[model samples]
Each structure stands twice: as structure tokens, then as C-alpha cells.
Target: MTRAALVTGGNRGIGRAIAAGLVARGVKVTITARDRAEGAEAAEALGCDWALADLLESDSLRQFDGAPFDILVNNAGILPSGSLLDNPQGYFDCMAVMVDGPFRLTLALAPGMIARGYGRIVNLSSGWGAFAEGLGGPNGYGIAKAALNAQTLALSQELPGNVKINAMCPGWVRTRMGGPGANTSPEDAADTAIWLATLPADGPTGGFVRRRRRIDW
Candidate 1:
């Protein structure tokens, strides 16, 4: 049977590349973006589908109806600037997008995935989130990603045998957040996410991976 997949923040950059890769693999892909025009344009470019979803708002999440997706790539995120003392609102937005949205979306989709006895969930996490790696990003960014990693681990245990969940650090990719000086390309960073989204039943779960190799989280 053909697989259906959903990618968040897929209007551009790494998310867009992952969506394109999934579409190339014959998965029926749906991407979520806050802007309708941009989302539609990206969807058209990828030859996939698009939905309006803003991860920052609970109401926006409630409006999304993308269940029945066999694979889910929670790639939507933001890099909140400033230190802990400076960016309270940015911190809130970061947590909303990186942690709360994925948590709720996973809760919503996991049931269908469990019932179908098949699923792959990939959370785009960061090395900055890892305790072993010293939680290196901006104030809210690392904390949110750490929570996301925890979410991945927790869900992996709760999910059924055939279903798998994992977190991955896409590395420093040349995306809007990553900046022009970043070393990795969008397509290169997308590789691990695409791999995680299409993992076999036997693939490792509850793990943090970079370039498809397991890493400390």
C-alpha cells in the first residue's frame, strides 16, 4: 500500500527538501505552512499537497486534519534569538512550535498509526538539545529541542511494535534559521529526516541520529 506522509514547515528550506524527497519516494505528502499562497506554491512545485497550519496556535493545530498519515515529519521550528533574560515571547513561540505542536500532533495521529500497525515519526531535533552536547543553542531553542527529544523517546515506548519514533539533528544547514554561512545544504540536511521518516519496522527507535548514525541525546 502507498504511504501517506505529512511534513510541517515545508514551504521552504530543509522541510521543503524532505517533502520533495518523500514525494520522490512515492509517498503522498502533505505540507503545512502558515501562508496559504506560499504553501500552495511549494506544494505545486513539489507535486504534493499543502495545508495551512500554524504550529504556534492551538486553534490552528485543531483545524488541521492530517491523520491517517503513515509517516509524520515534525520539521517545523523556530530559532528564538536573545538570551533567557531578553526574549520571553520568542521563548514562548519557540516552545509552542517545537514542543507543544509536535506533542499534540503526535497525540492526534498516533492512534491511527497504532490501529494501522504501521507508522514512522521523525522529529527534527538538534545537538544543542543534548545534555551530553551541553545544550548549546539560544535560550529557548535548546530547551524546546530537548523537550522534543524527550517526546520522541516517550512516544517510541508508548507506540506499538510496528510503529517507530526517532529524533534527529539535521546539522547546520543553509536555511533561513541556519544562516548563509552554515555548512550543510538543505538537501544534505534533509537526508537524515527522509531516512527517519521511511525507516523500517526494525529500525532503531527512541534515538537521536545525525547523518543516520545514532548520537547522544
Candidate 2:
């Protein structure tokens, strides 16, 4: 049987690349995006399934239909910009996406993953998740990601033995969120995500990795 996987925000950028990679590997892929048209187009291109769900809504997660996905990539996130002095709302939006969304989705899916006795969860974190240097564009974005890294470590320890959960700092990738001058491409970031999703049974967990090397939290 083919392994099943879901990639949120998979209509474009890093999420798109990761979904494509999983589909190419013969996994049954599902890509979720806020835009229905875009999500459908991406799913068609990748030859996979598609769904539209806004992370801010709890009902959005309930639509998963309880499928036992072998892998879940929580790549959906927003990077709203504002300085710490003037970004009050930005902080709330960041929390809704980077922190609350992932936490809820994982909780919703954990039982099925545990029951399967074989599962992989890859959370798309960032280099800023560890060290906070040079991340001044959006104070809320960096702060949310940093909290996500902590969640990854904490969640990993809570997972069952047969399931492997890890966080990945994909570095600064060239995407809408990464901006024009970013050095890396979505393809580069997707490599590590795909690697983590398809890890062997004995693979590492509760780890933060980039380019296959472990990084400090």
C-alpha cells in the first residue's frame, strides 16, 4: 500500500515542492491551501488530492475525515511584517498560524498515527527558530517560529515509540515569504522535508535538522 501524506500551504513555494517530492516517491499526497482554485491546480499538477482549509478555524481540521496519513508536514505559516513596537496584531496572526495551527492539527492526527504503529511528522520550522539574529522583518513571525521549535521537541518526546517526529529548519529559501534576495530555493528546503518524511523506522526524532545535520534548538 502507498503511504499517505498531507502538506499544508502546498499550493506554492516550499510546501509545493515538498508535496511534489512526496508524490514522486509514490506516496498518496494531499495538498491543502486557503485558495480553492490554487489548491486544485496544484493537486492536478502533482497528481494528488487537494483541500481548502483556513488554519484559523478549528472546523478546518475536522474535515480531514480521520484518514491515517503516514506523514504530516505542517508547512502552512504566515509571515506578517511589523516591528515589535508596532506589531500587536501581527503577533496574534503569527500565533494563529505558526503555533496554534500546527499544534491543533497534530493533536487531531496523533491518535491515528499512533494506532498505525508507523508514522512520520515533519514540522517546517526555520533557522530563526533557534538563533534569532537577522530576523527583524517581522517580530511576530520569528517569535512564533521559535515557539514552534520548542513544541517540536516537546511533542517528539510525547509521541509513541513507533512514530518519528522531527522539526526541520529549512534555512532562508527563495519564496514569497523568504523574499527576493533569499539565497536558497524551495527545492533545497523541500529536500530535507522529504528526507524526514520518508525516514526509516530507526531514524532520529525530536531533532532539528537542516541539510541533514542536527542543529541546536
Candidate 3:
């Protein structure tokens, strides 16, 4: 069977790389972006489908209703420069994208995946989300990802069959958010996501990983 995958914020960066990698493996990939033109351009370049969906806008997610994606990558995120004291809305926005958006999408898609008896859910988490690591990042970025990580752990228990869900830290990749000084490339950062996306029935679920190795939550 041809597998179908959905990747959010896949117009560029690690999300784009992961979409391309999945396309290479013959998976039917659909990428979402806030910008329609950029999303279409990337879809054309990657030879996959595209959609306009903003993580912050809950209504925009209606487009994905009933879509039975075998793999789902919740990769869209934002990093505003401010502490909670300075900008509370920025914190909420981060939660909307990094936490709430993924939660909504997962709920929408998981039912179909359950019926199919297979699924792979990968949330683009970060080391900043790890409590043992001090949760030190931008104001809401770390908090939102930590919430996402918690969601991953909670959801894993509910999913049935061969379906698996996990969170991944892509490291400091050179992207719009990561800046030019970051060490990892988008392709390199996508490696672990791709691995988790294609895991077997016995693979680990509800875990955090980086570079294909398990890491602390």
C-alpha cells in the first residue's frame, strides 16, 4: 500500500527536508504552510501535495478533516524574542502553534490511522523541553514543546495496532528560526524524524530522540 504523510510547515527547513525524504521513499506527502505561494512552490519542487494551514488558526485545520495520513509530522513553530513578562501573547502564540496545533491535528488524523492499523506521529520537540536540561530557551518555545512532549507520552497509550508516536529534537539546524551559526543542516536534522516515521511495529513509542538515539524528556 502507498503510505500517505502530512508534514506541517514543510515549505522550508527541516520540515521540507523530511517531506522530500518521504517523497523519495514513494510516500504520498502533503505539506502545509501559512503562505500559499511558498507552499505551492515547495510542493511543485518536491513533487507532493500542499495545503494552506496556519497553526495559530484553529479553523484553518478543517482542510485536514478526514485525511488519513499514515505519518504526521508536526514541525511548524515560532520563536518570538521576549520573556513571558514582556510578551504574554507571544507565549500563547507559541503554545498555539507548537502545542495546541499538534494536539488538534493528531486528534483529527489518529482515528483514521487507527482504522488502518498503522500510524507514525512525530512531533518536532527540542532539548529545551527537557526538565532535566533546565527548560532554557525562548519564553514559550520550551514550554510549548514540553507540553507537546507530554501529549506524545499521553497519546501513545491510546493509539492501537502498529501506530507509534514519538517526539524528536532536531538540534540547532540552520533555518530561519535557528540562524546561520547553527551546526546542523536541515537534511541532517531530518534524519531522525525520517527514521521515526518509518519505524517497525516493535520500535519505541512515546520517547524523545535526537540523531536516532533516545534522549531525556
Q: Rate the local accuracy (lDDT) of all candidates.
A: 0.91, 0.86, 0.94
Clash pairs detected, candidate 1: none
| Clash tally for model 2 | 0
Query: How high is each candidate's TM-score?
Result: 0.97, 0.95, 0.98
Candidate 2 runs further than 4 Å off: 132-137
- Residues 1-217, model 1: lDDT tens digits: 8999989999999999999999999999999999999999999999999989999877887754547888889999998779878878878888999999998888888888888989898999999999999998986999999999998898878888688899999999999999999999999999999998998868888889999999987
Residue 19: error of model 2 in Å?
0.3
The list of candidate 1 runs beyond 4 A from truth reads none
Best by lDDT: 3
Error in Å for residue 24 of model 2:
0.5
- What count of clashes does model 1 give? 0
Which numbered prediction scores highest in TM-score against the true structure?
3
Off by over 4 Å in 3: none
Return the candidate ranking by lDDT, descending.
3, 1, 2
Candidate 3 lDDT, 1-217, residue by residue in tens:
8999999999999999999999998999999999989999999999999999999999999878779899999999999888899989989999999999999999899989988899999999999999978897988989998999999999988887488999999999999999999999999999999999999888999899999999988
